[model samples]
Target: MKELDKIDFRILKILQQNARIPMTELAEKVGLSSTPVTERVCRLEREHYISGYHAHLNPHLLGKPPLVFVELKLQSKSGNISKISKRSAENSANYGVPSGVGRIRLPD
Candidate 1:
């Protein structure tokens, strides 16, 4: 990764706060021309510093309440065990927990 200068940091901070901000507005805020601001944004994306853009939605509005965590357990410590656990979790209707804890009892 390339070292970010003050300008780059400022750009990232502004974009993170509001990804939809217009380039012209961003340029004005950053004291640069629209062309250079656009170029910097493109460079950030190309360098994978900016992965992708997304919208934040409220789950309650979508009729889904927030989820709660659940504890689980598994029987064996094997590669197949992990696969089985993952599959079981996915198949279950409850929130899918990919892994579970395991415990062993030794003979006295």
Candidate 2:
């Protein structure tokens, strides 16, 4: 395997930012003509430096509105976790959906 040059590195960086950029624009940014840039991109793909192109989409676009995600870790699978869970539920019920001490405050 050969080492990547500055041009190759720049190409990879640009592609990461915008995978769907036109070949001519990408070539212009990297200071190369389309033919050489096209060949370089092909080489990059062949060498696995460029793996895949993907579409960037927002959560709303996918019909999944954003929500907070939480993960909890405990030392042991004991009653303490259940107690905490119950308290959290109580707080959520008393205040709002996500209401806890030292966390976000709910609207009045």
Candidate 3:
């Protein structure tokens, strides 16, 4: 991969700020036409600069109001993070957690 130029940096910064920005709007912001912007974006994707996009949801609307941070501590036990994440994602709906927490917090 070649060294990224100013245009490349601008494209990355803009996309990082708003992944959902339209191609035309993004081009306008970056001072380029949609065609070249699209090309650069495609090149960036091919080079693995952008991995994936996600949505931020309001937990309250999903019947889960409380938000809490959790820390996982491990002691000499090695586990696959991908497997853990997959299992948690599969069982999230049952526990009423959208995607962040591993457990549900019921009202007192």
What lDDT score is found at residue 36 in candidate 1? 93
Give me the overall lDDT of model 2.
Answer: 0.75
* lDDT for each candidate structure: 0.75, 0.75, 0.76
Error of 2 at 91 (Å): 20
lDDT by residue for model 3 over 9-46, one digit each (tens)? 99999999999999999999989999999999999988
The estimated TM-scores of all candidates read 0.64, 0.64, 0.59
Score candidate 1 by lDDT. Answer: 0.75
Query: Candidate 3: where are CA atoms >4 Å away?
Result: 71-108
**Could you give me the TM-score of model 2 versus the true structure?**
0.64
lDDT by residue (tens digit), candidate 2, 1-108: 679999999999999999999999999999999999999999999999988988767766566655444444555556586676665676443333222332322322
TM-score of 3: 0.59
The backbone clash count of each candidate, in order, is 0, 0, 0
Cα deviation of 86, candidate 2, in Å: 9.7
Clashing pairs in 3: none
